[model samples]
Target: MEEAAAWLAALDAGSATREEFEAWRAVDSRRAVAFAQVADAFEQIERLRTVHDPLPEPRRLGPVRLNRRNLLRGGVVAGGIAIAGGFAMQAAAREHAETGVGERRTVVLEDGTRVSLNTDTRISWRIKGETRSLWLDQGEIALNVRALAGPPLRLSANGMRFDLEPGAFNARREPETVALLVLKGTASAENRAVRVGALAQAIGRDISVHPAEAVAIDRARSWQNGQLVFEGESLDFVVAEFNRYLDDKLVVADPRLSRIRLGGRFTNTDPTELLKALDASFGIRAKRGESGAIMLSAS
Candidate 1:
């Protein structure tokens, strides 16, 4: 050990440099392994210094519970694969069970209620007698709360609570701001009950609840039945919803293009067909995004 310490001192003092270390490393792979160990130690220490103690774990509830929590639509979203800390996530190492990029997941809950998780989604839920409760922390998810004689089912997400009445439907989340879209069923957005044909949107410090003449249900299950239901919608609204199920998001560069009315039934996974229909029927050109998302601007 004394001789090893002396050697290190000599190296630090310019008697030896990285050239000497590389020569040593090359002679026996052990030297290279030793250097890597040192580097790893340094990196771990730096990471520990950067992160505070309290970091929440990624949450997941899988296909385990039959009537309690279920991953719908023949989609098996494996449990949340979390990294301990201090490194970027490797693409291959990450495991996610999700609907397609813009697709939907229609899962049948244990109590006969149905849930449709929107694109880029994850959820944790547990069923308790008399009162059904779940957490929708991130992503877009819809719920069709079965008509239960028991207490109302509660959904909490984005700092808001959704009291799903019997035969009520709702989709809401808070990432940047709180947004709730209610159609067919009733959902409590913010504090008010939003019924069929209503859309309520909320952001931090601001909430808006109004009775609208129209509603939009961006459901993944509807496509299985060969329907893309759009209710009193604009061109951009339909395009964006289409992007969620299709691999590409539509890019609407023109501001005015957003206002045109859009109502149609189109097949899922066929954005090109939808665009062609739009062009043929509406005379709008659809440009292609880098990843093939159709972008519609004024032609």
Candidate 2:
């Protein structure tokens, strides 16, 4: 799965030459299957990147719950997969919103619920008789839900459902994890009943509620204001966060340096300046790779 995912990433970045891809594809029959799965996932993601009409909700439940296990096997999404089951509710209207690399958008629902989407985020929402519903397929969002004299609003991410209250909060969904941080009001997970001031992390088959003491509210919410403030965060995690904002991704060549801690605030919209800051502060070397990926090494 790692090999497949690496191949997909390389292809997506235009780094994999035709000969190299053909050589890898011929190595094993299973490689073809893996590649097909990764390719299919990429196709799905690409479709989301472009503008599209909202998918008519099937007579069944709301948007299908994306099964995390099926999607994050070996940290790579599998092929020929299907979305998991969803609820049996109906909404009168459906709307889709998405942002590309280095893009952020603020959307106001009909009920005055404000949602500020972070970079590379995708979400869909709708309103039924007395219910407000939202499905976050990918990326992060800061939600400021409005008080309503109606049913509780529902926010679904990767098969886990969150009942939202009239308040402010943030939610981020990744390949292997879904995190929720409440800035105000309260939210309850489908079954876990996670606490406040914590980021609920959902992994395969389990949801762990961890205190978000390490996260500064101002820093965490700074992304909405086009900034990134990290306090003593690992290099690997920091790179991942920055990758969401740029077409060229950062790859740490040295696994040993992946966990090296660093702290600072950087503009979320600028990757070049961030790289310069990284090199100056940590003596890290940043260079462009053949695949157009930025390679980071300990200098």
Candidate 3:
């Protein structure tokens, strides 16, 4: 699944070649199935966006255009039959749960495991025989894994595997790393065990486990309540975090504004309170740009 996501990202970024993708996909039949599932999920997201947001007017900058042919190099369409066959084989067993921007949801699985999904998250799972497998495609989730007479609950995110004992844990998939916070019991990755109050960050094949600070755990816990807590974080960092739940992103227009440090607890779904606080406390002004983003600058 991670390899499929990487291929999709590379294709979206115009960094993948048809030859390379085909070679990778040909290695195993399951690879085609995983790629198809990821592609289908991406298409679903695009469809949802189209339904919620109207199409913008087309802009012409120059004659150069990156069409599908230029981007995909005829790979996706050529492999459609194999992908479709693969999808049909696994469609019945796999179940998916997802949330939109600024949305949260909690679900109970068949095995009595409870999962709380954060904003803009996607996850899929399947219970086959004794193994209960879950894949976090993106975003964050908190799991209260139920103890059953089995091997263990298996979870995969960002190419890392975690065998979690029946317990609670929060997992977030970041751009470069997968953060796992063990709240109860233990989680094993790469033959190492992470206990409660411990945080594990996985980058590629390497997993680093360390004790989590009190503030860090508190910040993680706050998100489930639709709140964000910061402690002396820079303006740029705060803005970036807020943009996760915002459609019209907040931008620091002035260079000096990015360096301002502040700490507060604010609602993650809306930036109005935070904006007002910034105005009253720091003499900062917020204005909407032509692109619809909120721009911040010194008053």
Measured by TM-score, the strongest candidate is 3
Q: List the residue pairs that clash in candidate 1.
A: 67-110, 72-107, 102-244, 102-245, 168-186, 169-185, 251-295
* Ten contiguous residues minimizing lDDT sum, candidate 2: 83-92
RMSD score of candidate 2 (Å): 13.5
Q: Candidate 3: which pairs clash?
A: none
What TM-score would each prediction reach against the true structure? 0.53, 0.67, 0.75
Stretches of candidate 1 exceeding 4 Å from the true structure: 1-97, 129-131, 147-150, 178-191, 195-200, 215-226, 229-234, 252-263, 282-299
2 or 3: which has the higher lDDT? 3
Give each model's clash number.
7, 3, 0
lDDT of 2 by residue, 146-184 (tens): 999976678877656677888888999888778788788
Question: What shift in Å separates residue 62 of candidate 3 from its native position after superposition?
Answer: 27
Cα-based lDDT at residue 155, candidate 2: 84
lDDT of 3 at 126: 73
- Measured over all alpha carbons after superposition, the RMSD of each candidate to the real structure, in angstroms, is 18.5, 13.5, 8.6
- Residue-by-residue lDDT tens digits, candidate 3, 206-290: 7799999887788778999999999999999999889988879998989988889999999998999999999999999999999
| Model 3 misplacement above 4 A | 1-80
